[model samples]
Target: MKKKIGLYFGTFNPIHVGHLIIANHMVEFSDLEEVWFVVTPHNPFKKKSTLLDDYHRYDMVYEATKEYPKLKPSNIEFKLPQPNYTINTLVHLEEKYPNKYDFALIMGRDNLKSLHKWKNYEVILENYSIYVYPRITEVENIAVLKNHPKIVEVDAPIMEISSTFIRKQIKAGKNIKPLLPLTVWEYLDKMNFYR
Candidate 1:
């Protein structure tokens, strides 16, 4: 059987508790063998200035997920082109991992609202299965994409936390102990990040 991997791609600027929670639930409830946090060097839609360095972000993820054997920090996009497109990353991962891995793009319902705007969005719909988690919105209308037979709506615990919120707190010199994992918090303190 092919190893089912959930590609949880994001900036993961600090890899907070909310991310870990969702990843844990993804594994517990789904057939995914592992959930890889594909850290994107840059997001085309977002401002790059606000982002922490890619290596810093990746290191934080490594620290945050160290305890979870099923969670991995993938640097595949680090070597790829800037303003990385999800479709391209998926295609590359499919070829690179070959028959050993099958991927599901894990995302929040909030992202689904603008999924049509993504590069090669239709190709993504036709090729890979999308697993969406609930966001702040209670009513998610996946029915709009009901035509896509591969979409999967997953009911996972939704946290009200976000990396932006955590970063803001950190910049304001507030304690973010509760926002991230203990190890991550320690590492951030030792490294003097987000100061």
Candidate 2:
């Protein structure tokens, strides 16, 4: 049987409980054999100023996912150029891990709203499957992409938590234990991150 891997790519400035929750749920409910947290070196659409150093972010992810064997922290994008685009990463994975694993792009509904603006958007829609979870925004525009053969709308638990919120709490010296995994909180506290 072929392995089905879901690539859950994000900046993950600091991994949190919500991210882990989603990954666990994806594996429990979906056909995915494993979910790799493909840490993007830089997100083209997001501002660079708010991002933590790539190594720090990668370490935080590693710490957060250590307990979950199915959740992997991948630095595949680290070796790629800056301002990494999703299509390029997907293509690279396909070529590098050919036939060994079938892949899908897992993202939130918020990302789907801007999918058309991405580089080689059409090619992505034509080639890879997209598994979308609900975000703060409703899936209003999703009807536009429903016709795409590779699209799969998944109803996963939606957590209102965000990295920005967690960062703000840390900067304010507020406790973020409720928002993040215990291990990640410990790592952040020990490193004095966001202070």
CA error at residue 46 for candidate 2, angstroms: 1.4
Candidate 1, residues 1-195: lDDT per residue as tens digits? 888889999999889999999999989898878999999999999999988889988988998888899999999999888778999898889889788888889998888878999999999988888888888865557577755677777889988999999888998999879889988898888988888
Q: What is every candidate's alpha-carbon RMSD to the true fold?
A: 1.3, 1.2
| Residues 1-195, model 2: lDDT tens digits | 769899999999788888998888888898988999998878877889998899889988998888889989999999888878888888889889888998888989888888999999988888788888888767666677866678777789988988988999889989779888887888888888898
Each model's C-alpha lDDT? 0.88, 0.86
Distance (Å) between predicted and true CA of 185, model 2?
0.9
The positional error of residue 155 in candidate 2, measured at the CA in angstroms, is 1.3
Total clashes for model 2:
0
Residue 37 lDDT (model 2): 94
Task: Give the backbone clash total of model 1.
Answer: 0
